[model samples]
Target: MARWRIWRPRSRAVPFLSLLLLAPLVFTGLKAVNKIGLSSERNYSRGHVTFVTVFTTYNSDPAEASKLPSNVVTVGKHSYSKVGRSMAILNTFIGFIQVSMPRSNVIILTDPNSKLTHGSAVILPIEGNYSRGNLMLQRIRSYIAFLEQRLEELETVEDINHLIFTDSDIAVVTDLGHIFEMYPHCHLALTFRNNKGQPLNSGFVAVRGTRDGIFKAIEFFKEVLEAYHLKYMEASRMLGDQLALAWVVKSYLPSAFSKFSKHEAFTVYNWTPPEGAGQFHGMPLDVK
Candidate 1:
């Protein structure tokens, strides 16, 4: 009679044990369904008109340029061959992006001596003579000038609203359509590395094409360059373009720059692999 009692209890508990085991599986299935629904909603919310630009010299190597994804626009030097295989790779990358994102635009700025064919991109000849010694600074200045020209060119068109600037070395693995959703109020968005708890990178940035805040930031960068005499020959080299950009925006318009909290948003991937693989990676294309 005691053995019979034990078997009776075990039979009763079997159903309870089975339910407990199945509870987690049921919850996991519902959670996955919820995630799929949310992902679909986010996809519908993606913006359509986003602009991306890259400033490259004629000397950039093709191998480095080939790594750029298909969503970027290439701004190259006048003589395509002079810029070397790197610029050619850049041109090819931009071509791919142009095909993928049909609504996007690519502009290449080159000197009068450039031999590049004007294909799908708008070719803007370098306005004045500038030396290669101050090429980095000059490239920044020319890019701003190119922005103004492109904005004017698109004045009649209402589709383009945001501008994204990326260095040639950066690569995009995910679709960046979400960035356009953060524009206008979020005048500027860029990735930065934590410099011992401070933001330190500026390889990638997004700006509202119509915002005056960017103009103010650019002027501040110019002042810093001029004040330092555009020469970093000193032991304490005046901050590079990225540092200068961060300081100018943080100092002048704190409200404008959106600092990325996660290190993966904009980072030096050479030292450490990005915590998340899909975001973006800013690699150094140059040897230095």
Candidate 2:
């Protein structure tokens, strides 16, 4: 009878075909497990996230108006004696935020004279010229200051690790804590509008809490502030904050910023909504 022998592979260093095939399955399985864990509230923690927004009070006081920046003074604009629409919207925004992300911290950067108060949100007084052109610059400054302060505080305290700055009009429909896990390497995330002329919508910005991330964020904002102050052209100031942000990201930090998805930037109007977009009558997807 002929002797039967098992065939042996020439190279033992090569991985087994079975193991190679299983590698992808194992990786995919691990990814699915991580996604499930992140979605579960019991497994995920939201204490590390802090939401920030600026609520500029409509100050009619002559004294406060006097503090306007030189650019505002040059424009000769009247004080907004009657301004309530945005505030009403902001209050509604806060209500949604409180209900959706109760565990996360919310900080409202408002004028010292702002009467708007919230039970859960921390009202941080940001002193600056809240004029149309100057407001954007001040907002950037406020973010920088807050980041710097938090970095200092983080030396001893370690409760927070991410800061999400958004426009007051944006309403939260769900907890955004999953973003950190989803974009593990993202240091800064900015929402983009479809318009190429003014691509970056400063409506939402997410900053990581690492020292490098904070510094990069600060640097980028400082460049934005400088652009506003310099006013490359008279039109630069008139084009609004979005243009300035786009210019900064393109010119200074093209690779430094990541983008939020269409779902995250689902606005009520202005830009075209994505397919199967749900009704935002109650601020459901303002900034998810």
Candidate 3:
């Protein structure tokens, strides 16, 4: 009788074939898992975000004759004053943009003496006394102080994830939600340069709602203003509000915030209208 040997597939061969078939499956499964994990992580991190814009206006210039859209709040003069008109125009633009964007919350800050309409915008009155001197500088100082005070008040009332400050003269051209998506961890975002290549206009700034290092910035501004006795274009240049703001960022909050270039999204400058697309120039109309 011929010796009968049971022929079995080589154990090594079976294992090798199994691995060959499973290799693609294993890789595909890992890729899917990774994708799901990343998606979940992104969604989880995207917490509730609120958008805010603040404008400071004083009732001085008559150029404030323009009109803003309904959503904007013109906070300065309240009684058809130049500041009111300017703020009105400004608020109009802001209201238009806010309506166009639909997701942002807009507020207008004005002197307590302002007579702004109730529904036009959230009107925040300046609370403390502003010492008389260097009118423009004093106004800027008071505005900044008002902003700080308002921020504190907001914190007390609700949770704010971020705050963006924009001068009435800058136009918004794009949805800024992408910015948050790009730099989710950043505490502040600001425009560093204008379309004309001018350097450092604090016309636009974005800051986290936390008050952690904000007081330091305020202190720096106070020091600059006091030391320079900022007044007049030349004297103000020595320590202008924008310059003081820049100094604070450089000296105190460099790493605490991030700045974006204006060329990236929008344009801001002294508006010379009938000439181009920029905020209106002069008082009242520009204040909104």
lDDT tens readout by residue for model 3, 1-288 = 111111111222111110000000001111111111111112211333333433444433324444343544444434354555565567665665454345555665555654554364566665543323343465456546755785677666755445555565554433544444445444444444332222345555555444532433344336545533543245453335556555434443343223332113222222223324434232212111
* TM-score of predicted structure 2: 0.64
Q: Model 3, which residues run further than 4 Å from truth?
A: 1-88, 128-140, 147-158, 194-198, 211-234, 237-239, 248-288
Q: Lowest-lDDT window of 10 residues in candidate 2? A: 17-26
**What TM-scores do the predictions have?**
0.52, 0.64, 0.51
List the pairs of residues colliding in candidate 2: none
What lDDT is obtained when candidate 3 is compared to the true structure?
0.41
Off by over 4 Å in 2: 1-47, 60-84, 232-239, 252-287
| Per-model lDDT | 0.41, 0.55, 0.41
Candidate 1 local Cα displacement, residue 215, angstroms:
4.9
Per-residue lDDT of 78-176 in model 1, one digit per residue for the tens?
232334445555666565445445555555666545454446666667654345545555556666676665555656765435555555443333334
lDDT for residue 67 in candidate 1, whole number 0-100: 53
lDDT of 2 by residue, 4-53 (tens): 11111222222110100000000111111111112223213343777898
